[model samples]
Target chain A: MKTKFKKTLYSLSFFLLSICLFTVPTFASGLNWNGHFQTETRVNLDNSALTWQETNLTLQPEVVTNNTRFYGELCYRRSGLLSQNNSLLASTNSNPIELNEIYLDLYAYPWRRMDLRIGKQLIPWGTGYLLNPTSNLNPEDLRDVFDFGRYLGSNALKATTYLGEVTITGVFIPVFTPAALPHQQFQALFAPEMPSLPFTVNEQKIESILPAENLQESAAWGVKLEKHLLGCDFSVSYVDGRYSLPVPKITLTPVGEKVDLLCELIHPRRKIIGFDLAGAYGGLGFWSELAYFFPEEVKVTSDLTAIIGQHMEIVTLKDTPYAKYLIGMDYSADHLYFNGQYLHGFPQEQGKDKLGDYFLGRLEFTLNDGKIKIPFNACLEVRDFNKFQESFAYLFSPEVCFYPEMNTEITLSLRLIDGKSGTNLGKMKDWDEIGLKIKYSF
Target chain B: MMRKTCCILLLIICLTFPLCPVLKSQELTAKEILEKVNSLLNAPQDQKLTLKLVLIDKNGQEETRELIMMQKGKDLRMGKFLSPASQRGIGFLSLPNDVFYVYMPAFKKTQRIATRQKSGKFAGTDFSYQDLGTQQYDEKWSSRLVRAENEQYVLELQAAKGNDTGYSQLILWVSTENFYPLKIEFYDQHNKLCKVLTNHKIQKIAGYLVAQEMEMVDVIKNHKTKMFLEEVEFDTGLSDESFTERYLSR
Candidate 1:
């Protein structure tokens, strides 16, 4: 089965390459080819161990003919784990190449003010800088916390219409694609433990039932209306879809003296209503986004007879119509640019106290006629006030980028995670490291 | 003594009455000259142009970019970079009321450029975004004829109050006959000369006089950007819908 999958992947890659080479020159006047090749190396700070060495080559091609536009991006990546202690890559040995984006944009179809886009595309929503609570239409790939550019585009259809100063957009996603989580080996270290039992279980089984694409009811849809009003841009959007986060539907059984726990990962249905506004006053720019989510209740069961009667925990994920809002401002003085955001998650749940309020700030200074830049970014969790949680997870990344030419850049960055053990950022305290990247654009 | 006073008052009234029309006519002439300059610079409704930008540093190192630009009315302009391979598929759109957006192919995203950043260099060129847009001289600045020599009128322009502009004042050397701006000197907020723009070549195309080649030099940085108009079409029948974000991807 693995060999057959690999064969299929290789054949598809070759077919795409052949088509690109043959058709690019034929439509040279309307076709554009641009991409970059990058190499990166990262090492752990405390252990003095090499974490990963990776090389990536990307090819982006775009063709615009009349009212139709086609864009596609193919990326080939090769990564090597230098240390055996790195748990993130322990389950995988082969480096995979992937197609990042492929989409077609059709304009002036049916009407002059309307546009339709079909295929795999990035439908970014919301106004937050780092975290977008309202942007739930597309799943995110968050395996690497430091990599913010990777977003898994969804197979969807989008239509937008312009009416004078107002724009209305509608999106429909027929297939259900879940967010990719971190590697299992790394996740096992942070998995919450169930209540302990007196008797040992013989075997443990875990199952995940993903949302079925074949089911018509599993489809996701979103609508957004944006307009410029009162010297500010305002938008109201709503998404009706399955929650990207999985809920554990656990069943506990007692056979003889041992108890068996079966945990099933399920995606619950949810709805989100969001509003955002962005505007600028003089030299300062400001943006704000607010989202309210209504999620179904999740039920969890454990195999502990002594703790409770039946051992069932009813967890309400986003039970009370939770709201998350973020307000940010950006300003520039001379060569220094600063952006700060204050995020507040209202009415935080009991068990989800760790997912609290945060403040994110970024400062960038450009030098050498904008050729060289130094940026410092920091995120601090501010909700917890207890002594243990007082040392809440705070992540700081300082990076230096030097552009040797217009198409080439070298960057050096360091990620510092500070907090006590068992805190949010403290859990990944071992992953603190420095990285260097060099990229050349073509 | 009363008769002498009356004669003096009548002489004062006679002297000031005739000079008022002459002064009014001079003001009208200055305005007419500006209107002519505006007509030469602004398209009737829409325009299409192919432009080549060459950036030269103090050390003589040069970088060049080629692009095609389309403009609708006085507020909307879109530019697509065509050369340097890496810059291909990059699009810049400027809307009314100081809204600007840039789309990058690699990121596959369109980002808004803040109003404050409009005064910065445009794509690493010497020209700012404000300079690249259609020049609306009368809306932002008040002009007066300073002098006329050798068939050229030198006009001094001061920024109107409450206008957000990068420069405090500008002096333009315009041809008296054609009203085409031949040279301009920009002054900073402190009233210091900061940049100089000179038109090197002008050509008559389709019965319209246009500046074909121009150079802008930053006196402080000693950097220069030279622009060449390779192709131009006025009143190209472009619609307002084409300037909307719906067509930005194309």
Candidate 2:
């Protein structure tokens, strides 16, 4: 069956290639290429905490005209993780990390458009603030899916149709690294450090405990409605996907079996329903969104499955339902603009306290035709260990950017972390860092 | 027999002599037509004239405005207002390019109108910049007798060279009785019927005759506007500085 499916896919790809090669010359606008490279470094104030440094290089080659457009970007990144307290101790990749993005856009029709991207791309969806459909395939991280922010090297096909002021779009994701995979040689590529789990994870049962890796593919369809009326804008969407899973080792306990694992690599089927509302008038504007995710089934390993089957005493346990919401406002006049936003995520279903709740806020002020901008942001996550929520950690960052010209930008940023236990702010102030970056965009 | 012959001769001679008056009016020659029109146009150099101009469009809505026109030789200064808020000032001294300037109080500035914008609307009206300038009898038009109709010669005047006037050409009907232009139709650069210049305020100023009030309309936009000459003068001393760019920008 797998061989047959592969053959059919290969034949379809060949057909598409031929069509592109023959039809492209007649529809091409003009050839253009743009690229940029930048590197940034961060250090702690007391030189007593961890520092973060990274470099990014990207290039885009595009063809554009009155009706048709085709563009793609190639990107590379190199990062170094360091301990401020121990200056000599740091982890750096001996080689650079690279990702590719390529997409072809078809805008031939006046009412409908299509985009087919076959490589690394940002798949942002829903109106929620957190707990989104972010499937960053960090194979090295302990918590596979929910911990990371962006997915890499995923293939997607999207189609959008416009009717008056409303636009409806449909999308499909295929052959991406599944968020449920276990640690491997490329595990570090996902996140700097993986979170720790309470249960003992036997090497043999790891595969069974997680969904299939990049080998598992999924398809999702979504419908959205947007309307602008009475000085306010509103939109809502519903999305669903069916995914495959990878099997894991089964452990037998005397009182049946204990299964503690993450199943359904993507979800046999997952649904996202959300909406956004915004208003703009005079110098003030406000926007907000709320979204809820419903899964047909949540997978778990034999041990975790046995534990759940026995109704273990874990509060706000794994595979719990959740909801996310975000609100923001902006005011602008002449050359100056100020904006602020707050986002929150919490468990929607009772007795499922697996994922922690997060509160995030950001403020930005811009000056001089976007030539200078100051930004500050804070995020607090209340960790729910044993499904019992307790202490919270706050992450704060303040940054400033100066763009003298369209091609060049300079920025200074700082990162700080603080924690609180119950109503009292904890004494754990482990990390802080200051950073600078110079970027040239073409 | 001698008595009978005298009577017959007398009757025959009376009938033939009565036809002379009919023939004389038809003999309105080309030179005679041109001379009369030129003499009427040669109004006194310094006399200012006022008139109420009424413009009627294809839709038959008539717009009326008051105008003050002063013409000194080939130079002219004109001010027009159908209403208080719709006033405009124009000055043109015919030289090489017929240097023209228009003052719009709303903009608080005067603009040196180029030849291309000559056919555009004047002060948000159907009348174009070309419609604002005078169509001197001899300066712009070269006439040919198309045919004699009634007491007027329907002269078709082709625009003069170097003049390369805005109209592809202009056709005018001048009265043989006073050499005053009765009706003029202007064709655009594309040789399309663009405007109709109707003389409503035809009057004699000093020894010269002028259309004290006239109306011009755009055929496409269905708008009619009038230019009324309130005060007109012939041979007014309009200095070169009046048409300078600095003055125009002012």
Find the candidate with the highest TM-score and give its number. Answer: 1
iRMSD computed for candidate 1: 2.3
Off by over 4 Å in 2: A1-29, A46-50, A82-100, A109-123, A126-153, A179-205, A208-217, A242-269, A296-320, A333-336, A346-359, A365-371, A380-392, A421-429, B1-250
Model 1 vs truth, CA RMSD: 6.6
List clash counts for every candidate, in order. 0, 49
Q: Which ten residues in a row have the lowest lDDT in candidate 2 chain A?
A: A136-145
Worst 10 residues of 1 chain A by lDDT: A346-355
Each prediction's fraction of true contacts recovered: 0.23, 0.00
- Chain B TM-score for all candidates, comma-separated: 0.84, 0.69
| lDDT of each residue in A27-52, candidate 2, tens digit only | 78555556677877666677544455
Expressed as tens digits, the lDDT of each residue in A1-442 for candidate 1 is: 5356447645755565567556755865667777889998899899878786778898877877777777777778766556566543532224466666677778877688888987777888776675666677887664444565356777688999888989999999876766655555345322433445455675677787776545465689999999888877789999998865465665667766666767677778878899988777877778899887777766665656643445655353435566778899888654688999887752122123324677889999987666789999998865565653556678999999997676788999999887766554666778889999999888
Residue lDDT tens for model 1, B57-84: 8888887889899988788899888876
Please give the DockQ score of every candidate, comma-separated: 0.31, 0.01
Write down the lDDT that model 1 would get.
Answer: 0.74
Predicted candidate 2, C-alpha RMSD: 23.4
TM (chain A) per model? 0.87, 0.67
lDDT of 2: 0.51
